[model samples]
Target chain A: MTSGYKDLSITVEFRGGAELLFEKKKNELNLPGDEEWTLRRLLFWIRDNLLKDRPELFLLGDTVRPGILVLVNDEDWELLGQGEYKLKPRDTVLFISTLHGG
Target chain B: MCSVNDAEFETDDELMQPDEVPQTEGAICKKCNENNAEVVLRVKDTYCSTCFLAASTHKFRATIGKSKLVRPTDSILIGHSGKAGSTVLLHLIKAGMSEAVHKRLMYKTTVLYVDDGAVLGQTVDQRKSTISAIREQVHGLGFTGYAVSLNESLHSSEPKIYPLDEEAEDLKGDSDVVDLFNAVSSYTSKEELLHKLRQKLLISVARSLGCCKVFTADGATDLAITILSNIALGRGAQLPLDVGFVDSRELDIKILRPMRDFTRKELIYYLNFHKLETIQTPGLTTKKEPYTSIQKLTEKFVTELNTEFSGTVSAIFRTGEKLSIGNLEASNLIETCALCRAQLDTVFTNTSSLQATEFSKLISAEGPKGNIGKAAFELKKFPCVIDAAENVPLRDSKNCDNCSCSKGKEKFEMSAKNFEKYLCYGCRLIFKDLDKQHSIPDFLQNSVRQRISLDDMREEIADFLL
Candidate 1:
């Protein structure tokens, strides 16, 4: 058997109780870098690698659930082309669930 | 073009595509018409970041200014959660009051953070840290802040100058909090209680701090959800008071929602642009199911619909704005509800309807058992004797305390004797489920007691005049 995949490094952060789905509010993941990572691809990766439980709460239809805002480098994912945006090395992504009440 | 039914089953990718790209790439600002548009808002409005900020600030000022609910000299208490919406509101208020702004506000502003960690089931240490962070945030903004427990509503002191929690003991009431947690009856009641208690605490804090106006940062989307949820909870009559821009239901301290016209998206954008940090405040969802709570379900429904059917939230809010409880005369307005303190509707005072309701309740309670007992069975057998007893008269409108009629055993219990007279229909329904009468909060109980005593005095005076 030959090992072919390398880890892609990126930072993941959660806010507004989204962190409850993960071990901590922030996590650094090393995803397989064999294929280029899009935001959609990264979501699946996070689901497989980091999401602890309640996957439905964090994901819906290969993307973050409705009312959960996704920001890439402090800018809205929608403005930056949403799920199509490519993940780069050392990129910081934040998922904020506005659904949580005060 | 697909029909609405077909569209509901469309793939997420197709749904995400822009339905109508009204603006060309790198469009000019809608307002200034010179700078490159950075954001496209609503259907057509596009603006650069600077223009968007200015437009949002202007809209905020207009929202508050046009309402005429806030006075120039009145002190305002802000119910701040340090979240995106409240942060933007605080920033806008500060900017509007700055020297650079032309129409500078002249009112003093104080921030009040209600620690809801107890409800969220946070540990004491976690709550302490959260409070300190909030205190620092308030201090960093150069404003005085007060931190109080959400449980303060269980037993609040008389409104005083210093509104902060004086005692260091845990704010979570031992039995009350346990009952609230155990009362897992319905998500609506728990949500309703928390909501009513939060409002009570906010109003108390505002009054104590001498703030004439209390401002909450509830945006259009939030208010729309609330309007529907309240309607589902049998509070349609309170639409105006719940969803209106200015709620004067509390006469002395007006509660204002200056951010009513803004959407959550706009507020989040503002927070991001300004590089503002928000604290993550846990809510009932921490330990509760989304579908179980009417509020959570409604919020999810509204927000999800808003994505597929754009402008749904704004449309709902527009409908809510048109609701009014009619022109209440002074005499009518004085008859306030004991719990929510809103003016009573008093439209269902027909004696026939009241008796019908009582009869139905009795039948439902005594259903299955057929426990009419010997006395009720005997009364049923003799209609003439029952009619004669009803006419037996003159002692009072009600039967004697120890009499069988007064203690009908099978009769449904009315909530807290005369207290039911002062409660609105919604509160009365809620109080019916609460098993412990003593668990009623001090504010409501005191008001009820005072009203009963005043009613007693009026009856005595009427007797003397006769």
Candidate 2:
């Protein structure tokens, strides 16, 4: 899949029960760097590749689900551009599910 | 990135959208006005780490202080579920107790974790590991820790609590717990049953430990969902007790939800800022579809609305705070439901929903021409109805003529019809979903029997009373 371009290494972390859908708590992935990447694209990619079950839970329409909080480098994705925020190399993206019961 | 342009760029449209987090790269803390703000809470309220922590700690302390319910030297139990809100609650309690002598909390603290892994379908090893992790967290905080399984609620006697330092024995009657849940018809009823059983277990454990007050970590968002779901479940009468800061439903034991002021977002922020790790505890509807249960559907609704409006949860919570049931005088054990223990809301007027439901059932059971008068007569026979009658003196066991206290016990056949009268409106709905073949928990059965015996005693003295 990565024939033309270098690989963009990044980390994806899940907490607050979001990991249950992904089957693991954290993942390190290398995406093909041929095309410009945004969080919207990253979500679809994660849903296709990493999500093992319940894609509806991790993604709603074209973005991440409402109950799931997305953080980019420890900042709220809302402060960033949400789905429109461009993903850079080595950026740490985290998804935390607030729907879990206390 | 320029501060001058950023200030000029603020518009009414941006101000109206409280759900959106504006650029905080150069924004100063709203509280301290010194350091650059790191967190944006309640929409535009920005705070630095130090200010946010201080404010949160102050809120926690203030909640407890304003209540004046906890006394110095009193032992209180903290119900920890290992979720993010509870993890932060534990951290806050630890920090409070370790503060300076003048400001430190004086109440002794213990932690209790009721593992519902059986109902959540966790394997034995998985349950053990979860409990072990909780044990480590509790011990690391220098507090006494106790663990119990959700199945223990089925036992008549007090639940067996295993110390965190010691190995927990295999819980007997696990099948009974599983059977009880399996018998429930829907996910909504299953969740409600789980909640009630957990609550009963908590109260029983607190009573055994001689702790009068229990701390639960239900945040604003949680309480908001609970408020809506409780109403939908026909528990509107007990809304005050259900979502209040202090739940005195048991009278002797009080359930305090001090974290009711904080949102889930704040809790996650607190944990992240402090680098505290939380265990992911799966609940009944954890991986289920969003609309599988009433509670889950309400949760999804509340959370999604809160995401779009930010103030949605607190608005619901504040509205719930203002609710108070006027007739709390009948809050004694006998006047409460035999199951969930909320004050019995079974008594209804002629035009009430309860009557409408009973009429519908009568028509379905015995044709449209069924004896309505007979059904009304049967409804009036309920103890809650008798208690609600005006000018009737309260009947006590001592006033009975042919008291059964000294006689041999009678075999109690707890039928669904008889059991329905002892439950509140909400519990009646849950009971309706229960399978007839399976017996109820011993605690509930015993309570109902006591109520029945008391009623029998009242009937024996009916002729003598005015």
Candidate 3:
């Protein structure tokens, strides 16, 4: 079985205002970029450099609500991890602030 | 039909005939089961007003344990939205100061109110509502009410400004009125006009009262506000943090806020639980202080932020603190401006506060080859403590009213078309072919509106980027 991912776009919605966008490539579960260092690297470099912290995220074949609050194409990425769980090359990944206020 | 009408009339007449008044079934309130329960507290077993006050008294004493507030002694200032937080804090402080922990009455308290005369909160009606609420909550609780800048306009006459129907005649005059008017227009808005007056009052009190610590209910929401104000004469980073207050003071005064941790919901709940609702309720003053102003926008932004990313905001604040990336002003206490040296509010205070202070180093502009990298580092580095004499201003910002934008010329008073021409290309399209019917919030929405329709007023009004 082949398992790897690439060409993922990451977007973050700030609580105050503005939606941040970032794009990156993946190698197996690790991001191919140096900035994949901190989770913040992706956000800070979204408009500047994608190579610095392109973001590489790994997931077990099975997990639920990873608590990282990640969404792929507006759908929680956790739901896709149960089986046959890996992102397609052209998938978009997003991290949104958890908004619980009413 | 005639027979039916006649029979109906006779029956109506008999039924309508006055019945002699029966022995009165007393005009008692059904909810409280007592005649005198005109105003009853249904939530707490429907008690009379007198009883309700008594019940709240215990909560007040318990919550205000250590305030050690002596009667007619210490002056307490309360700002409505901000003051609400202070009220909660004072109660807690009252608790903390109380000898009750050691079994004794420790303090008597007096409260002082300085109404900012918030333009958004204009009108005698609006003022009355807010004042009444604050008053009602403190009725008989031994508090003094002091209203300042209540209705004073900085100008003896009106100046030229936005929604511009009123200022047309003022523009035609030959007196220094036009330039002075523009100066005033450029410097003050309905909000700034009111705020400055209130602040001046606070400053006066601080200087006069020999204030120990003047507490303004500044919360995290306020922390995120535009620190520098264009209207404030380039006084960069004007509303400094609690620490900034400490830095500004050479005297014994301290400005404190105790309820910086909780969200508005938590605050509301805390007050409700303690039966300590601030007398100043919102919404009643909507007429004078409409929904279009910056303060309203800021309040909405925080509320929306709370709704959108509840815990993240507080988390971000924690991060900024740890990272020390807050809006700290780098000043040159000794360095004088080459041209004008009235102590630059910033290294670049001649401009509005919305302009990022450290922008001079980050110029992607063609200069020395290594400068771009240095500029990037400057932008990325923590907020610097540098030569306050050499700060650069962010040029992207143009409108001064919004905290996020730089204070450029007064464009709203210019030909609407010229204003459109000067906008950033991104924001230009938003204002193109501006419609008279819609009210826009800021340049961002104006751009977004160009692509697609937004909520009704989003086209013409802006919240200012800060």
Compare the candidates by lDDT and give the number of the best one: 2
The residue-by-residue lDDT of candidate 2 on A35-80, one tens digit each, is 7788999999999999897788888899878788887887776656
Native contacts retained by candidate 2: 0.37
Ordered list by lDDT, greatest first: 2, 1, 3
RMSD to the hidden true structure, all candidates: 6.8, 6.7, 28.2
Residue ranges of candidate 1 with Cα displaced over 4 Å:
A1-8, B1-40, B43-47, B159-184, B327-334, B346-417, B436-438, B463-466
**Shift in Å, residue A54, candidate 3:** 43
DockQ of each: 0.42, 0.46, 0.01
Candidate closer to the true structure by TM-score (higher is better), 1 or 2:
2
Error of 2 at B39 (Å): 2.3
Given candidate 1, what's the lDDT at residue B148? 72
lDDT of 2 by residue, B1-466 (tens): 6455556547766544545556654467899899867777877788888999999999999998899888878888889888887788888988887867358887777789998988887788888889888887777666778998988888888778898777767655377788889998899999999988888888889999999889999998889999999999999999998899999989899999999999888898898888888888778888888888999999989988877798899899999999998764653434789878888777766677877776667657876688867776676554465455521332232224535453323434566666677899999899789887878878787787678777766767779988
- Tell me the lDDT of model 3 at B438: 35
What value does the lDDT take at residue B149 in candidate 1? 73
lDDT of 1 by residue, B1-466 (tens): 7556775757787554534534344467778999766665674566677888888888999998897767898899999887777778888887778898797988899888877676767778787777777766666655676777776676647532233333234443444554654554565676787777778888988887788889999999889999998887767778899899888878788889999988877887777778777777767765356687788889989878776566789999999999998665646326878778787753343343434455456567776776656434443334345334532331233323623252332232223545566877667767766666335666676676556446545655776774
User: Candidate 2 deviates by what RMSD?
Assistant: 6.7
Error of 1 at A100 (Å): 2.9
Candidate 3: tens digits of C-alpha lDDT, residues B1-466: 4454546666555554432322222123334455332221111123333343344444444422334323324544433332346566555545545465444433333344544323333444555455555555544233443433332222222221211111112111222212222233211243343343344345445544444445554444444432322212233322333213222332344444434444333333344445463443222123222244444444445534443345534654453333322333343223211111112233333243323533553463546775676565555432343322212222123345433332333332333432332232212322342344434323222332222222212423547523
Q: Quick one: best DockQ, which candidate?
A: 2
